[model samples]
Structure formats: C-alpha cells, structure tokens
Target: MYRRIRFFLTSVLFLCVATAFCNDKENPDAIIGTWLNATGKGHIQIYKQGNKYFGKLVWLKEPNDEQGNPKVDSKNPNASLKTKPLIGATILRDFVFDDDEWNSGRIYDPQNGKDYKCFLRLKDSKTLLVRGYVGVSLLGRTETWTRIN
Candidate 1:
C-alpha cells in the first residue's frame, strides 16, 4: 500500500509539470521575425529594440498623393507632425509580451501620424490580431497581420 501511494503521487507530480509546460504561451522566439499587413493596406516590420519590440512601415499599397507627389499626413493637427507621411515611419512601439498577449504598447498611424494605445494577440501560429485604440479599449480597431515567413 505504501509503495502504491508513492507511485501515485509521483505520477501526479509529473503530470502537473507536463501540463504547465504544454500550456505555456507561444514562444517569444516565434514572434521574432518579419510580419506583413495581409489586409494589403500597408506593410510592417517588427524588430527588437533592447528587450522591447517595435514595428515600422516598410511598404504601402498607395505610396503617393493624387498628383503623384509623395503623400503626407496632412490630417495631423500637430504642426510638428503634419509634414511627415507614410514612409519611414515607426508605427508600432514599446510592445512587450506577457500572459499570452502583448500589452502596454502603442501603434502609430502613418495615415494621420497619430499614435494609439495598442495590444497584440496571436490568432494562430501565423496570424496576429493587432488592436489600436484612442481612448478606451472598447473603442478600438483590430487589424490582422500575417507572418512573412
């Protein structure tokens, strides 16, 4: 009876450890690569900055103005921000992963050069759901980003 009880306890302990390991969040290493805006409105590249992650605009479907001049984000009310357009802009900033989601981050919209609070979650191994919000998270937009690999 003593030997049977000991074996049962050992088996239970091993199962607990195995379950924890298997249910762990997606590996951070899996996120360390280029991803594209599969919606085709724009392209983004995510990279590491120290221990944080950031994403930048690499391409756009509409890269120019109606007159064929380089487009600018004229809608930005900030005088210092209105002059820059969709090129060479850092759109995603200060993203960190925890608890199976990326929180406490911001995404910049090159279309208006405005920054919004952002969060990211993996919908699948190859798809990410990027949420950008202005005030409350209840009022936000989610975009789908596809892994480039």
Candidate 2:
C-alpha cells in the first residue's frame, strides 16, 4: 500500500510538471509574424520584445518617391527626425496583451507624421484588427491587416 501511494503521487507530480512545460512551449500570442497593411502598400514584421510586442515596416510598395529618392519621414513633427527613412521605421510600439487584445500601444502614420493610441486584436489567425484612436476607441479608425505567413 505504501509503494502504491508513492507511485501515484509521483505520477501526478510528473504529469503536473509535463503540463507546465507544454504550456511554456506553446506561444500565447498568435500575432507574431509579417503582416500586410490594409492598403497593401507595406509589410510590417510583428515581433515580441520581452513581454511586449512591436512592429516595424519591412517593405514598401513604393520605396522611392517621384524624385527617385527613398521615401522619408518628411512630415514628422520633429524637424530633427524628418530626414529619417520610412522603410525600416518603427510604426508600432509598446503593446501589452490585455483581455483579448494588445493594448496601450501607439501607431505612427508616416504619411501625416502623427501618432495615435493603438490597440490590436486578432480577428483570426490570418487577420488582425488594428485600431488607432484619438480620445476614445469609438473615435478611432480600425484597419484590417492580413498575415503574410
């Protein structure tokens, strides 16, 4: 009887450890990948840094402007940063997963050189809903980004 009880407790402990190991192996965030923006003009690679998520533009449909010069963040509010190229710029930053979405992030629009409060939600494995709001969520705009992979 003593051996049987010891064996049973050991088996349960092994199972609990195995379950935790498996959970650690499984990724909690399904949003890590390359995603194409709604306009189909740019591709951003979403990656995890620490406990947060960030996205940066990797490719652009039109890399160069009409003058054949590489597109830049010309409209950036900061005159010192206006010369920075837009192709590899970090457009999304500091997103923390909360509830069913990634919240407390900011998305920058290189076109107008403005930043908006952003939240991200995965509609499906292949679709992501990116919302950028000014004051409230209802006052924002949502864009659908399709996963590349």
Candidate 3:
C-alpha cells in the first residue's frame, strides 16, 4: 500500500512538471507587438490575419519631409503607391510561423523601392531578428528589432 501511494505521488508530480514545461514554451503568436527597428528610426507593429503574420510601419522618427509635410512613399516603384503615406504601409507581408520562425514573407523597402524575401525569428521574448535577402539568404542583411510593448 505504501509503495503504491509513493508511485502515485511520483506520477502526479511528473505530470505536473511536464505540463508546466509544455506551457512555458513560446506561443506562435508571440511576435504580435510593436517593435523598434534597428536604426531606431521607425516602429513596426506586427499582427496576424488569419494564420499569417504581417508588420507595418506605425511610426517614424522623421515623419515629415523638409517642407514639414507628412511623409509619403515617394520611392515606391508603383507610381500610384508613391503618394501613399508611409506610416500605415505594410512593409512585411505573408509571413507564416514554422518551427519557431516566421518565413515565406516579403519585406518592402520604402527607401529603395524594393522588396526582398524575408524571414523573422525571435531572439527572445523581447528581441526579434529580421533577415531580408535578395537572391539567397547568405547575401541578405539581418536587423535586430526590439519589442516596444
């Protein structure tokens, strides 16, 4: 009877520990938040739509032109988009979460009027690593983004 009781207690303890361990794992939606870009010039807000993730420039350090007008996507390749405001523009698109990383996305560069293949991974709960590549990942650039909220 004592042996059986000990075994039962041990099993309960093991189950409790296992459950805690599993629950402590990071959620796939943990990336949803406002993040400060590496240059500290812009703030990107990441959000989910359906099952995919996207990020947009929500704020900019220099949100105005020399004439003090609201900044627009002046460098956008599409002539129509060139007049679109940059603050609400979606810069990161179509990212899908997989194996602790977000991939299969495109990152739009308003400064250069270019789009590059991109991927994102969390360095921790508060830090994100973003990579944008042209042809291959090895030829890409990585930027560190910090959570803002």
lDDT of 1 at 110: 60
Q: For candidate 3, what is the lDDT?
A: 0.93
What is candidate 2's CA lDDT for residue 100?
70
Best TM-score among the predictions, by candidate number? 3
lDDT of 2 by residue, 1-149 (tens): 99999999999999999876654213447788999999999999999999999999999999999999999999999998899889889999999887678999999999898999999988777888999999899999999999997
Q: Give the best candidate by lDDT.
A: 3
Off by over 4 Å in 1: 1-25
| Candidate 1 TM-score, true structure as reference | 0.72
- Deviating ranges (above 4 Å) for candidate 3: 1-26
RMSD of each: 5.1, 6.0, 4.0
Candidate 3 backbone overlaps, count: 0
Instruction: Tell me the TM-score of model 2.
Output: 0.80
Clashing pairs in 2: none
Each candidate structure's TM-score, on Cα atoms with residue i matched to residue i, is 0.72, 0.80, 0.84
Scored by Cα lDDT, where does model 1 land?
A: 0.78
Clashing pairs in 3: none
